[model samples]
Target: MISESTPLAAVEQAMQALLDDVVPLASESVALGEATGRVLAEAVEATMDVPPFDNSAMDGYALHHSDAGHTLPIIGRVAAGDSPLALERGTCARIFTGGALPEGADCVVMQEKACVTDGHATLPGDVPEGDNVRRRGRDVAQGSQLLGAGMRLDAAALGHLAAQGIDKVQVRCKPRVALLSTGDEIIEPGKPLASGQIYNSNRPMLVALLEGFGADVIHIQHVPDNAEDTRRCLREAALAADIVVSTGGVSVGEEDHVKAALEALGELNLWRLAIRPGKPLALGRLPGGDGQLTRFVGLPGNPVSGYVGAWLFLRPLLGAMQGCTAMAELPRLWATSTFGTSTGPRQHYMRVRLDFSREGIQAHAFTDQNSGVLSSCVGADALAVVPPHSQVAQGDLLECLWLKA
Candidate 1:
């Protein structure tokens, strides 16, 4: 188990240790209608060329390049979807957009340049070969790998699959996650709060965030501060889902029981990290309903810390379970700091908004860096990483992570 005083760098190592034991879920074929946002389990190859045949890129006259400036007989007209026609030596075809080029035609001249009168078409001089023509397989070649395994199917991917006549695709199953919110002081929203009780906002926020990440929340329950109750809820979550995420009950306080509960059922792989607001996080695995191991992640109680923990840990964990290699790292962009702050012993994740300027993007940290303040995240564009024990001055370049899609 990792100690509470472990360095921030070790936290990443511990996270990787947990990921090394992750086993991606099984794959299944799904219809195109339900494939969006799903990870592809198998690579896709183009069965046919994108264009399939040589076609016209515009409305023009299809003829041989050597026939320029010569009045050729207009033997036939071809529109889109028309079968290819054979052209004779002094003849040209009047073609519309996407019209298939005839066998003997090697070039196309725009209709504005090709004046047609009666049954004859006149082309201008110097009309280059292959002009205004889209060659077969120019965009995508047949038998080429178009999409690789573990790719998240978005609109463009779906369209590419449709272009290849793929009605169904093999994709990884969605991860089933269980969320547990602990602490006796936490009360459900819309209900009157008793003495010293506050409304629970982490449940809904995490639920939406997990759903946005393409995870299915199989169970979401509120566990009290009692150790026995926490253990029972954790056991149920481990049995019901592929991953169990718990908020609170990981600190060293007497009320914190998540770590003790995890130790009872399994091992706590990690205990704390050297990061501000989200220092207390636990990761482990426990026996699942099927006798396999179920992943467990314990997040801090503070709302902001919980959000950050989920962003840095849970998102990538779920992605790994879905076999997405790209999601192994968080998306980061460089930005100049518009403001500065004195550093402490731990790494700081400041909620900030980014401003685009002529020079470069700039990050401006929120006034209140408190973990419990949810207002700081409302207009925040990203979480700017500030290293420990370093003084940051204005105009300093910093690495910023995107918080929104």
Candidate 2:
């Protein structure tokens, strides 16, 4: 079990051990139109070469290279999608862009460089063979791997698949997730707030974050600060989802029932991490149906902690389940700090806005570093990782995690 003083690197190592055995969700075949934002389960190979035939790249005269500087009769004309025409020796053909090259032609001179009159065209003397032509298989070759497994299909990837005449592809299924928000003091928005009641902010924020990470949230429930209720909700969520994520009720306070309930129904692997604003994070596994284990991650009740935890933990978990290699980790970059600060035992994940300029990348931290200040994350670009027991000065280099959705 990770203690409250365990460093972030040690916690990451522990989490990786849990994730090593995770099996990706099943794959399904979907049309190219529905494949956007899905991860490829298998490599896709090209069935036919792109631009299957040698064709003219411009509207010009197709002629033999030896006929350069000589006037030749224009025997025939060919437009795009037309069948290849045979060109006799010393004769030229009027060819448009994408038109198949004539059998006896070796080069094409653009119309700007060719003078045509009396059914004859004069070609430039310096024209070279294969000029103004698109060779077969120049863009893509037949029987070649077009896309690899675990690659996310974006617009360009989908278009590339379509270029190979592939209308359907196999992709990993979206990971199913269950979100639970705890605390009796938490009330839904639009409801009358009592003196001690605070509106529930973690549900909507986490739901959006989960969906953005490519998770399909199948279940969402608000569990009161009761131990029995927490246990019941977790059991049902474990049976239904690949992962069960809960916010609040994991601390050591009297109202904290999630930790106890998780222990009662499953195993708590790690309890805390050495990170500011999110130290009370929990990791565990519960038994699901079919003898499979459901991953559990409990985040703090504070809105900012939940937000930060979502990026740090939940995103990578979903990426692993969906077999998306690109989303396996957040992109890291080094930037010069524009603000000065100091830290103690816990590493601080300071929310900062990044500035790109000729000088260098600069990280500008928000003024308030408090965990409850959710506004600090509104326009934040990256998380500046400030090491424990260190002091940062202006212009000092720090590693930052880019916050990409």
Top candidate (lDDT): 2
Each prediction's whole-model lDDT (CA): 0.88, 0.89
Query: In model 2, which runs have C-alpha deviations exceeding 4 angstroms?
Result: 1-9, 190-192
Tens-digit lDDT track of model 1 for 167-238? 999999999999999999999988998999999989999998888777999898999889899889999899
Give the range of the ten consecutive residues with the poorest summed lDDT in model 2.
Answer: 1-10
- Model 2 over residues 256-338: C-alpha lDDT tens digits? 98888988899888787778879888889998989999999999999999999898888888888988867777899899999
Task: Return the TM-score for each candidate structure.
Answer: 0.93, 0.92
- Model 2 lDDT vs. the true structure? 0.89
What's the distance in Å from true for residue 305, model 2? Answer: 1.6
